[model samples]
Target: MGRIIAIANQKGGVGKTTTAINLSACLAEAGKKVLTIDLDPQGNTTSGLGIDKDELENTVYELMLDECSIKESMKKTDIENLTIIPANVNLAGAEIELLDVKEKEYVLKNSVDYIQDDFDFIIIDCPPSLNMLTINSMTTANTILVPIQCEYYALEGLSQLMHTIHLVQERLNPNLEMEGVVFTMYDARTNLSTQVVENVKNNLDTTIYQTIIPRNIRLAEAPSHGLPITLYDSKSAGAESYRDLAREVINRKDV
Candidate 1:
């Protein structure tokens, strides 16, 4: 079975979507069949893979509403082994629509269950809130990959996220675990970044990936060009860090 990992962070601007896009691309580059599902209504992950969100026929919205089969919604990306279930603004209303469905939280899990074995890994990019969409992602995922930016307030809202995860583990998916925590937007020149890293290591019980994503211009620029850093500028530090992170993830026994 493919390991379903949700790239989530309740805090926005934490590099959650960036990690979701690049990590999956890097994993595909490593010869693993990877599928990324954009659970965020913003559809940034969909566009980051070079797919036009406005041009999509079938999206994650239709899949969630039982309007289309999962296979019909899957879009092959420019990357060889990477595929995506694109999402759009239409998905923003799925939460309200799902309220009337039976086993509403598991709708996503049930929808994608049959297709799990086709990929080596399935990564989900969750919204910045702990809403119904995020719950569905957590319920379906085997583990969650958290991307924390190197900042003073990094640990501010983490407790609530952990509480949500604890609730999911207790009532929804008992097998759910934290895949790993990754530090993003690190500035080596700043002592604050170093302090944030030390603080995170001291505070969290989860394993942290050693490869730190620096504050690279290429990383921020790649998304605007509708491409992953690997495709946009492979030699950049952003691409190198994500590739290293992929290797670490592949080697992890816990993943």
Candidate 2:
């Protein structure tokens, strides 16, 4: 079975979607079958891989709401071994609609359970909030990959995120574990970036991946062109960093 990982952070502009898109592409480049689930309503992950939202009939929303099967929602991306469960703006309503439903928190988990063995990795791009959708992503994932931006408030809101993870571990998914905290949008020339990295390393219990994703124009521009960094500019620094990230993730000790 594939390892189900949720790329999550409550704070926006943390490079969550960028990490999701590029890492999946790199993993597929290494010959691993990767399935990316775009759980965020923004649909950035969907468009990042060249999926048009207007052309979709079913999406992660339908799968989570149990209106459609997960297999039915899967779509091939431009990358050979990478597939995506695209999300659209309609997912914004899922949080409220799923609230009154039975096993509301496990909706995503249950939906993914049937198709766990289909890929080598299932990476979920979670919404930038600690809402029911994020909870569902946590419950569905075996491990959570947090992408922390190297900024002054890098650790801000992390306590709340950890608390939610603890609650989920205690009462929902006992097998759930933190994969690691990845440093994203790093500027090597800045002292503040160094300070944030030092603080994060000193505090977090999880392993910090050696590959730090530097802030690059290519990384930011790739999504606009509906492509991963690897496809957008294979020779770029952004592409190399994501490839290294994919290698680190694949080599890490499984929980």
Please name the candidate that would achieve the greatest TM-score relative to the true structure: 1
> Against the true structure, what is each candidate's TM-score?
0.99, 0.98
Residue 106, model 1: Cα distance from true site in angstroms: 0.4
lDDT of 2 at 123: 96
In model 2, the worst 10-residue window by lDDT is 246-255
User: Distance from true position, residue 123, model 2, in Å?
Assistant: 0.1
Error of 2 at 8 (Å): 0.7
| Model 2 lDDT tens row, 1-255 | 999999999999999999999999999999999999999999999999999987899999988888888899999987999999999999999988987999898998888889899899999999999999999999999999999999999999998899999999999899999998999999999999999999999998887899999999999999999989998999999999999999999987665
* Residue 140 error, candidate 2, Å: 0.8
